[model samples]
Target: MTKDIHLYTASTMNGWKPVIFLEEAGVEYDLTHIDFAKKQHKHPEYLQLNPNGRIPTIVDRSNNDFVVFESGAILWYLAEKYQKFLPQKPDERSVTLQWLMFQMGGIGPMMGQAMYFQRIAAKQGEENLFATDRYVQESRRLMEVLNARLAKSRFLACGEYTIADMATYPWARAFYWAKVQVEDLQHLNRWFDEIDARKATQRALTIPKPFWAFFGKGNVEVQERENADRFKSDVISRSNI
Candidate 1:
């Protein structure tokens, strides 16, 4: 089948997974920038494809025009379709899946809640102290779990670069903005630096062009404040919940 993948994504951690794997696998894909400022993802047309109305949905034109939502699923879909990143051996693949699940179930949700409370919840009040502290602590704990794993293995699973790494790298790489103590986790820093230097990873970081300048690791500080400002002013401030 001719590779016809259209990636609908915004500039977020989960949004990077599919494009990262695609770039790493050398697969061709089209990027459809989802402008959250316009609520593009929640449009009736987009909802027909992904009711979840989330960023990072994929439309696979080669596969009967199938649409895949949820970034984790998109990562698995592309990995299996291209036979890249994900391991071939059962044991290694299992380990990789375990780490992927760790990100989806543990880090993503905890960090998301922490971010919402710390950033968006300002609309509700000054700061959601309880929710922010609770989720941030949980996020830190998850980072510690990952740091411990990296202390032993160079990568998260099977000692090789796999979807597990692709799945978690963006989130882990955001340790500073996530309010994580970077010095407390030297092992993860080493691992993140290695991945950050890869050429493929470099390409993956820039999904929609003309906007890549704001997405680099070094530019994270400015981007973080900008993202929070955009979210708060554009959406959260206008929303009661």
Candidate 2:
């Protein structure tokens, strides 16, 4: 029999979302690593899989070899397919999708641009201060919006854990690298801690097959500290992008 799902991914914010969904929804799947440094995603074969040429593409082998790309789209797809994390009621579903869109359109893009400008561009001595400052602030602002929404409820949408949470969680925590002060955002911090403590989430965020920012499977604290240091320095000298 064919596999249930085949996920082509690297380890990162967007890439990790579908993995979490598959695990939380209890879907069987196999993961194939895409080498970012090798430009593996842009290869012709991978291009056939995802025309946009990105990670987190999935072929639903169990579903007639259907393919899906774009992290947000994948999250929505998994939620619908499993009818697990997404709300079923119409109003609730709309709200859930709204927050998912918040991440897809706002948080993810801003954070990515901010990191690239702050970490990669700055180190190259060709930093676009204007772009960096704008995106960092925008990313921080988006986080604060999330913090405010979370303040009103335990989760982002439907007042419960849903794909909205899955979509946003990975990118939100990277505010550390964005130079955003999240500690003051009490509700956001609380939600983050709660999700971080989930058994499934813990499993997701590991050295191997888990969620975003897997602390790896070693001295977790030491690894986190090292990452902290790198993020604080804007990753100026890092070879890996």
Candidate 3:
């Protein structure tokens, strides 16, 4: 099987995870932007590749066009396929999976909700101060967890850079946008700086274009207008199912 892959992704944190793995693994892959604004993710053709209709699904052409969805699962799949970021020793492998799960279950959801409340709901004038503060606090607490972990170890798991770090870095880097400060989390800050300086991360952040930087800098008013209609349509469509 060849290393050829086709990635359908966007510029969101979850979307960047697998791309970071692919870049670090030095694998050949083509990318197609999953345009949320256009609702292309819900298209039947794309839905077949990922029944959940989420961004960052990958089709492994080398392995008989095997399809993988969910960002964490994609990372695991690639790691096993190439024997790259995953550890071989059983104990270290367990440690890697543990931290990967920590990001999947803890960091991603909390920070994502923080982003929604701060950047979306609040800005849309549907501000829920309680919800915003709740998520932001939880997100900061998770950062503290990572900060403390890093104080003892260089990487998140396996005593080396692993998929766990790849899975978490995108979300961690966006802590500012989530309104969850990492400035006080000195160890976490140091970890972020190291990953941010990597050449693979530099290239990974650009796959499908950088959000919160270039393409994401588009007019907020127009995006809000479009998103309102798109979300309403999505709700109606889901209700029928």
Candidate 4:
């Protein structure tokens, strides 16, 4: 019997994390590009799979038909199902889950805010400076915490290359691209360099598009402006703000 997994994701930081995990775990899966540019995520079909209407949802066609959304949940599901990128011992598994949750709850959201305020909010002008600084500082603090943890262990948890690393690396990559310096966080820089050299990660980063298309875009000012206006009209129009 053959296993089938269908992945629907864009090429954002969160979207790439599961791709990296799948590649690293040597899982054969079908990739479907959800056209985020065309607002395809909000369509009824995609929303059925992910009520949040987000990218990086997966359908496990191998088993009795299971659907998983949220990048962290997808990673955990794959790791547990494959029984490859996870630990066996109870304590080790606990540690791995801890770091995985840390990435999901701490680093990912903070850095997302940082990216939002730095790149997206820049279009709205410097009036959003406080928001930018707040997130940037929080992101840097989380990076430092990871740096301290990595200084003591080879990987994020259990001293092995586990899902914790996979969960955290994409956000670290985004942080690097955002030019939020982590030179002082030597341990993190080292791990970042290691992840940068992985074949799985390299493939994940460039998946769904060519290298040029992924990075060779101009400033997103126009797109951000349009999205902001649309969001305000669609979301805020129904509420008192």
What tens-digit string does per-residue lDDT give for candidate 4 at 146-231? 99998898889966899889988878756644546687889998998888788887888777753222232444455446545544
lDDT of each: 0.80, 0.79, 0.84, 0.78
lDDT of each residue in 168-240, candidate 2, tens digit only = 9888876765666677889999998999887776566551443233323455445445444544444454434
Error of 4 at 223 (Å): 10
- TM-score versus the correct structure, for each prediction: 0.89, 0.86, 0.88, 0.86
Better of 2 and 3 by lDDT: 3
Instruction: Judge candidate 3 against the unseen true structure and give its global Cα lDDT, from 0 to 1.
Output: 0.84
lDDT string, candidate 1, 66-183, tens digits: 9999988888888898888888999989899999999999988888777676655554355767877898889888888988999999999977899899989887776555565667
What is the RMSD, in Å, between candidate 2 and the native fold over all Cα? 4.7
Clashing pairs in 2: 204-210, 204-211, 205-211, 207-216
Best by lDDT: 3
A best-first ranking of the candidates according to their TM-score comes to: 1, 3, 4, 2
Summed over model 2, clashes come to 4
Cα distance off (Å), candidate 2, residue 187: 0.6
Candidate 3 Cα deviation (angstroms), residue 111: 0.6
